[model samples]
Target: MSGSRGIVGEKWSQKILWICAIGSAISLYLVGVERQTQNRFQKMADDLDDIDYSEKSGGDGT
Candidate 1:
């Protein structure tokens, strides 16, 4: 009985470890994707800032 219990515990621990490893991988992937999105958006915002909106709109700062 004791031997069976030990085997069960080992199996559970392995399962938990696998779950944690998969979760960590998914979390890292998401973080990387989020960072890439943020950087892309930041670049777009910077480009917009550099654009001369008044010239395009033909407005004299009014």
Candidate 2:
């Protein structure tokens, strides 16, 4: 009886550990995706800042 209970407990613990590991992996993946998106937006904003909009407007409408 005691041996059976120990085996059951171990199985439950292993299942819980697997669940936690999967959750952690998913969380990491989401964080990486968010970071990449933020970096892309930051780069786009920087490129826009580098543009000479004033020159393109023909020197303040002549």
Candidate 3:
């Protein structure tokens, strides 16, 4: 019946919407994680730069 077909179509639409939402969430999470990782590494590099490496490397011969 036409009504039954409409019900089936509605279910499929809901499933597709759920899939898209989940995919978007995962994408956003991955992007955020990547940005955090980059920031962490940048902070570490800044911390290293703040140290006096010249005094410690004097005996290393360059």
Q: Give me the candidate number with maximum lDDT.
A: 1
The numbered model that scores best in TM-score is 1
What is the alpha-carbon lDDT of model 1 when measured against the actual structure?
0.90
Question: Over 4 Å off in model 3, which ranges?
Answer: 52-62
Task: Give the range of the ten consecutive residues with the poorest summed lDDT in model 2.
Answer: 53-62
lDDT of 3: 0.87
Across 1-62, the per-residue lDDT of candidate 3 in tens digits comes to 99999999999999999999999999999999999999999999976765547556664423
The parts of candidate 2 lying over 4 Å away from their true place are: 52-62
- Sort by lDDT, best first: 1, 2, 3
The 0-to-1 C-alpha lDDT of every candidate, in the order given, reads: 0.90, 0.88, 0.87
Full-model lDDT, candidate 2: 0.88
lDDT of each residue in 1-62, candidate 1, tens digit only: 99999999999999999999999999999999999999999999876765668668876644
Q: Name the weakest run of 10 consecutive residues (lDDT summed) in model 1.
A: 46-55
Clashing pairs in 2: none
lDDT of 2 by residue, 1-49 (tens): 9999999999999999999999999999999999999999999987665
Candidate 1 — which residues are off by over 4 angstroms?
53-62
